[model samples]
Target: MNEIIRLQVALETDAEQIRNMMVEIERDETDRWYDNDERPFIPGYDSINMQKYHMWDKKYYKIMYDDILAGVLLISYTGREHARVDRFYIEPTFQNKGIGSKVITLIEGMYPMVRLWTLDTIQKSIRNHKFYEKNGYEKIGEDEDERYYCKTISEPIKEINRFNSDEDFSNQNFIQCNMQNVDIYDVNMRDSGFTNMNLESGIYQNSNLSNTRFTNVNMSNAVLGDSNMNKIEICHVSLADAYIHDTNLGFEEQKAPLIMERCELRSSRIVDSNLQDLSICNCNIEGMKIDGILVSDLINIYKSSLKTEINKM
Candidate 1:
């Protein structure tokens, strides 16, 4: 009889089962990529480390088919807009039955607010690459040993974290949180409150910050690139020397005031914003518009020598 496949939070007791499965997975991977001279697996590869880190994320789950163990998954929260599918392997016995694809779909639903799902695998794992691509993920980057993949979510994020006072945040959780000078990449942070956090010198790359609050935060020297910042509210924030590129900052319904001073903007678009009383001086303005009126054309007409002749006529 076919058993129902489901995902449940894995308990510590399941470590042995997961480790045995990992051994098989490691053997398969090693066989696929390594020569006879190389070892089949890393030295000191312990099940304890796997179980420990999996529990650290608190999102590790056991993939069960009917009442039997099928596999394990370790998806961890990396940032506000991304989740990392650290490990996804089906038991060799359960392979080629469409269980992996179902697990992916389950994960997507589990975090509806996540804008991007990212993972990495051995560079030579062609089968893994194809599986991820078939499930809507695309290759983003790669290194000498691993290939990184990402899938973007188009759904609107409506999840909002409850508002809390700054006083309620403990110093251990806020001040000494050690959030500085760290790399936070590809994490889903929808509707989260970073309103009073001091994230100085942090690097937030390829992350989703939609509907996230960043009021009164000191993000000085932080790098925010290739991320989605849709509907984010940023007030009294110091973004000095911060590098922001290829990111979305405009919303369709809400009107937000964007103030730029002594900053360089190239190849970026601004729409549906309040630019009242805007002043421009000593800057190169080209190929621009406001309400379907080209500012460049208006400036040419007003500043041209022919303006006097037209006025007289």
Candidate 2:
């Protein structure tokens, strides 16, 4: 559809249409997602008096699509890179035409300085969860009746290419930033944090990463050499097509001869690896597979063959 979606600052004259539009939305959503008996719900657009009262200090916008009133949004912007969607809804007729998603993108574009956008949804509304999650809003937490969500906006520094080297950035907070292609070496990063970061194809040499926690990290096609990983704990991680090598002088040998000892592997999958002369003792072999065959099935077949040979004897 060739449509132009935009947001305009709502005026006092637009109160009646907004009230009627919200009524339409309330009627459509009644008994569908949330209970009608819910208390402390949004009553801003319920009537003209409430609408004007709530729109006093907030930036209320009338969502316009093709010069038509498609929806209404009440945003509470602090002008300091934080905003919240107090209330947002599309008219019943304008629902499910991809207008709601486009309007959200429009709001983000309108407030380029906003680094965090937060909103709340009815906790029981699974459909709404799918919609918001698909648009990059993560479900942060849930209360008695509502669920909170927020999306962090990352704006890359396009002008600067090289960060000054030999700098002490310890305890410095870097939030909502895109630091791709940044390089560093021989720095004190201890007692620092790297959350929601991307280190794909990154190089780390002669660095101290001891006592660091990496959760939900993807280190695919990467190398870990000449590091002290003794007594390190890993869980629920993917090591597909990966190699583990033991070396001397704390240096990884080119020829990987894995010698895993004192490891507790629970519910882990080892697929398509070389295990010649490997001994497995005191472990669970139930439902284990080898070469696309189950170990239990092979054992049963061997038992049946042995019984037949004894009867022939």
Candidate 3:
């Protein structure tokens, strides 16, 4: 007879139980799949360490069947507004059950936006793709190799104006607020501290964000078109998949920061942003800047083209 299972968000004390489940899952996954030289999937100590650290954040969930550890679901926050369903796995013995779908439903009810990624190359896991589609996620886009399918969760809350216009938000400590899809046009946001906030898919046109401080914020998939971001201090911010066209980022200085890693910066004009000190690894920067300067070994673009354009000035 199949036994009923219980699902709960893991607490810090459940670390030991979760760790053991992770080990079992890794062993089972590795044994079933053969490792390729190019993309080998090795179960290592580092992966366990990551699980331990990530579980402490209270974002992970552990599934138990008949009071025994079954599997784990890893949830990572893209900020406060968006959460990514990083890893969802059930033991081979527990496959074909409704555990995965139940967990996804729980996540969708709690978070505004949840996303998960799967590979199309995994023919064996084609049922997994169908499972997600059955659970209300849509295939938004895909990467090269026809693998890495991005699936988005249900729709976000739609309000004409979610941000308070009359409130004196300047010099306030804001944390983990959702400003997605809000029309924040032509506003002056200065000397504000926004940490771990989600500004995804939000429009910030003709807005002024001078001397604003942003740390650990997710600006991914955000539209910063035609915004003025002068002298802003942005550190450890994720600009992944952000659309930044015709924006003025001049005179901005980012220090020892994680700026624009794994992002696309198409048609964005960045000038005099002391980006020389920042790391521009894994970013696609296009278009021209009048005084664009580069100074880090991390950026290995066409130096002659950049220099020639600079020399002409």
lDDT of 1 by residue, 151-196 (tens): 9887777863332323433222344365543434423556666656
Compare the candidates by lDDT and give the number of the best one. Answer: 2
Off by over 4 Å in 2: 34-40, 157-313
Clashes of each: 10, 0, 0
Ranking 2 against 3 by TM-score, winner: 2
Per-residue CA lDDT of model 3 for 1-313, tens digit only, reads 3666666777767766666666676666555643552332322322444555556457677777777667777665543343456567787777776777766666666665333333233333456668767765556555542234445443555542234546655555544555454544224676666676765555453457767776766666554533466545554454554433322335347423434444345555553244455544444443333444543322345676788899999
- The order by descending TM-score is 1, 2, 3
Pairs of residues clashing in candidate 2: none
Q: Clashing pairs in model 1?
A: 79-187, 80-187, 80-188, 80-189, 81-187, 81-188, 81-189, 82-186, 82-187, 82-188
Cα lDDT, all candidates: 0.68, 0.70, 0.54
Ranking by lDDT: 2, 1, 3
Query: For every candidate structure, what is the RMSD over all alpha carbons to the true structure, in angstroms?
Result: 19.4, 20.6, 15.4
RMSD of 3: 15.4
lDDT of 2 by residue, 1-313 (tens): 7988889888888888888888777767775655558533554447776566545554788889899999888886643456778778888788788987897898888877677788888877787888899999998999978899999888853343444656666667777897665544335655445566666655453346666666766666655543554434565566655545332323345433445544555446664345666777666777687777988899899999999999999
> After TM-score superposition, what is the CA distance of residue 180 in candidate 2 from its true location, in Å?
33
